[model samples]
Target: MEGTPDEFGAYRLLAGSVVPRPIAWVSTRSPDGVDNLAPYSFFNVVAYDPPVVMFAPVGVGDDLKDSPRNAIETEEFVVNVVTRDLAEAMNETSATLPHGESEFDHAGLDRAESVAVDPPRVAAAKVAFECELYETLEVGTSTMVLGEVVYAHVADETTTDGKLDVEKLDAVGRLSGSLYATTRERFALERPD
Candidate 1:
């Protein structure tokens, strides 16, 4: 906390210290009609009122990754929640494929039509958010994309009386490096009034 940490060191410290982070399984469509899918650990909800979410895409070297580039070009994307069951398939999609190659096909995942966005969503995803590009910011070596949800899809079994049930969601989270966490263990605490 005293001196400035180097780039790689700072990234390692931040990522390692952040504990478990939710993964945004972002899906986007390229201008040439290719579907791109990838998982981003640097993602979270930004605003509840507007249903806004953000995901940061850190490019390799000087090349912008396909997901963010597609979102920027099309101004649309879908955020599919990564559950425990979809963990392996989600990781499969992270492999770097040549431009215009469909990760869905590579991962053997079926695609579902999106209502408000051009990009498709993961058919097996229990929950998905169709979003329109709201803003984008260049932060250091990553590009932060902010999107407003235009439509949402949720599995009926994951809901309790029309509301999402956390236990049923079975979401997975990213830890440091190749480690991951699940929602199997949970504790609720009462907030101060």
Candidate 2:
């Protein structure tokens, strides 16, 4: 179970070991106004004080992917939460289209204008975070993008007393390969004081 940290081996190990990771359905707009959408499994919340989130996107070749490239160039992006109902569309957006191609069109998804960012968000998402590029880190073949959320959108159906209801949200998570996990079966455990 040990070997050199080569590209394929390392990725397979890490991706397989991480039981279930949240998918960041990110959207960005190219400088030329082309809207880009893609899903990144290597994503998570980084901070709460400033409400920051991070997503790591790997390059397709020598060039960067549209999501990261657009965010870097325009300094804005949106993270749309993928739910069970939107899983198929989210997967469609993951396809590597020609640079500047609109994933929204390819997936037949609708876009909604973001409040604090230029990039549009998926209209069907239950929750969306409008972010401004806070920082970027180069780690091997991936570019880690840290974004400070300036605004947020939450669907009324997914909220209870202004807080997100996980059951109602019904979010989906990314597993290894083409697998996905659901939030349908969940249990609560109170934290110790």
Candidate 3:
């Protein structure tokens, strides 16, 4: 725990320690028009007002992962929220497919046209954010892609009083290797002014 661990070791440590991270079920399209869908646990909202988010997709060996690759090339992506209902389909898309293969097809999920970006949204997803690429930072072996959310679609049931209701949203979270968590259990706290 003192010195730097290998990439795999560090990844294991980080994933285990992060504790219930929000998943970004990202969708992008290859230059040849092949649709791609993959889930990233290394994802979170970076800022509000302007509405920014980031996801770090690590390279497989030396090659950039398809999510970051397509986002970088196309300058567009869609972040779809994962729910218990869509867990299996989201996991299915994580398989390593050939560059031109479409995960949306592999996962048997329907694609809806995004309002702002070229990449399609998962029609089964309760929430989807269409984003334009803001920047990408080359980490050690991973690329951190930041996107500016330009549009969002939320299912009518997922909202309450014009705000997102976490209990109703029922979004899934990443807990380590094969583990996932739900948003059913939560608590609220008042901030000190």
Candidate 4:
């Protein structure tokens, strides 16, 4: 089906109806020693062999966002999982802060040093992936930063027989503007043999 030819309208419609998007609660350390924390909806696991994850920072108004900048400059970052318990604090970090200012301090989040990367992880996060910057791709005004997972931390409560229990994780997701969702009910689908 053919739709309207305006980029703004089309993009808005696409973003609005994408069901639920997993949020990447990203933390990065600025060059001047400030820690930054923020959430990005445009995130996903890209590869498993090298264990790569990627997130995109959409250019607001005109310039690249802080997460992308810090990841590129520092070559490291931590992607924290947004669980129901930390949803409020996660939302607080989404506020637009002035460059060089840290959302971690703004949101009053705790920090823990990563084992494999310099960027710290959110102390209260249910799961955290410590990553080393693998690549950065500039797409129009936005920037996609890809990283290789060097270490991971999962809350003890969320682990069951060497696997993460989604119910215990209680992960939150992004849904359009000012809308959020949680992983309360889930189902498993298997491919036909």
Top-lDDT structure, candidate number = 1
Task: Give lDDT tens digits, candidate 3, residues 51-146.
Answer: 999999887334888888899999999999999999999999999998788999998999999989999999989999999999888888788899
Candidate 3: C-alpha RMSD to true structure equals: 2.1
Q: Which stretches of candidate 1 lie over 4 Å from their true place?
A: 1-3, 60-62
Clashing pairs in 1: none
lDDT for each residue of candidate 4 in 19-92, tens digit (9 for 90 to 100):
68899999999888888999999899999999999998877333767777788889999999999899999989
Give the per-residue lDDT digits (tens) of candidate 2, residues 50-113: 9999999886334788889899989999999999999999999988798767999999999999
The local distance difference test score of each candidate is 0.93, 0.92, 0.92, 0.88
Q: Rank the candidates by TM-score, best first.
A: 1, 2, 3, 4
Residue pairs with colliding backbones in model 2 are none
Q: What lDDT does candidate 2 reach at residue 21?
A: 97
- Cα deviation in Å at residue 35, candidate 2? 0.3
- Each candidate's TM vs. the true structure? 0.95, 0.94, 0.93, 0.92
Model 3 poorest ten-residue lDDT run: 1-10
Best by TM-score: 1
Candidate 4, 74: how far from true, in Å? 0.9
lDDT at residue 160 of model 2 (Cα atoms): 88
- Model 2 misplaced regions, further than 4 Å: 1-8, 60-62
Name model 3 segments beyond 4 Å from true.
1-8, 60-62
Q: Between 1 and 3, whose lDDT is larger? A: 1
